[model samples]
Target: MLMTSEWAIILDEVDELSNMILSSEQAHSLRHAYTAVYKDEELAVEIAAFQRMKDHYEDVQRFGKYHPDYHTIMKKIREQKRALDLNERVAALKIAENDYQDLLDEVSLLIGRSVSDAVKVPVSNPFFASSGSCGTGCGTGGGCSCSS
Candidate 1:
């Protein structure tokens, strides 16, 4: 397959972006925060508890609301979710992860717009939720106005 000069340049630019991502401050912070989260024994216990509760909930889901332990499973799941969500280490890790993701998203948006507004870019802006065809998970789809 023959590759055009423009496509070759685009590929080189993307490679540069990947290098930037590797050295970005957010990437370092994300790794540090992720390590901290895993090193904390308290957080690990909470995560384990949450996983167990989730497994229990799935097991009960087969019986639907008719299960005798449905109410108990629901209550436990809520409790576990709250415990995990409220952890400071987990929260910090999430912030770091989002920061890194924001950098990547900005790069993608820039590349997309450089080509055309009709080009879809996946963005995970916390403040500005897109009505575009890039869903919450950030994937391109038809009829998207994701690029800016």
Candidate 2:
């Protein structure tokens, strides 16, 4: 798709934001936090517990069994996952990563919407479709008069 100058500017800003986000140590920390936590026995235990509960849930769902402790297991799984997510340095890094990602998404959405709006004019409408600045006949040896 051809981006208008405005959208191009916005995309450039988004790219800079992305570069800034990924270049920081916090981003690096966020990217590796999960694996780092899993290497620690204390933190790893919570991850294992969460996985076990998830497996149990899947089994219950697969077999269509009414496990009496399903609710309790789910609660424990959430708690364990929460604990892993809130591990001090990891939490801060993850928050930074998430916030930066949201910003990037917003900018991308804005550019996409603008591009969509710019292209909304029908192909049959020459006044809205063509730039009207073509010096030669549509650059195709007298094809269409307007710059299609």
Per residue, candidate 2 scores C-alpha lDDT tens digits across 1-148 of 7889999998898889779767766667566764666567876676677778888777766645367776776677677777777787557656756655555444444454567633322222233234432322245653656434
Model 2, global lDDT? 0.60
Backbone clash pairs for candidate 1 read: none
Each model's lDDT comes to 0.78, 0.60
Overlapping backbone residue pairs in candidate 2 total: 0
lDDT value for model 1: 0.78
- Top of the candidates by lDDT: 1
Q: Which stretches of candidate 2 lie over 4 Å from their true place?
A: 1-21, 24-29, 32-41, 61-65, 117-148
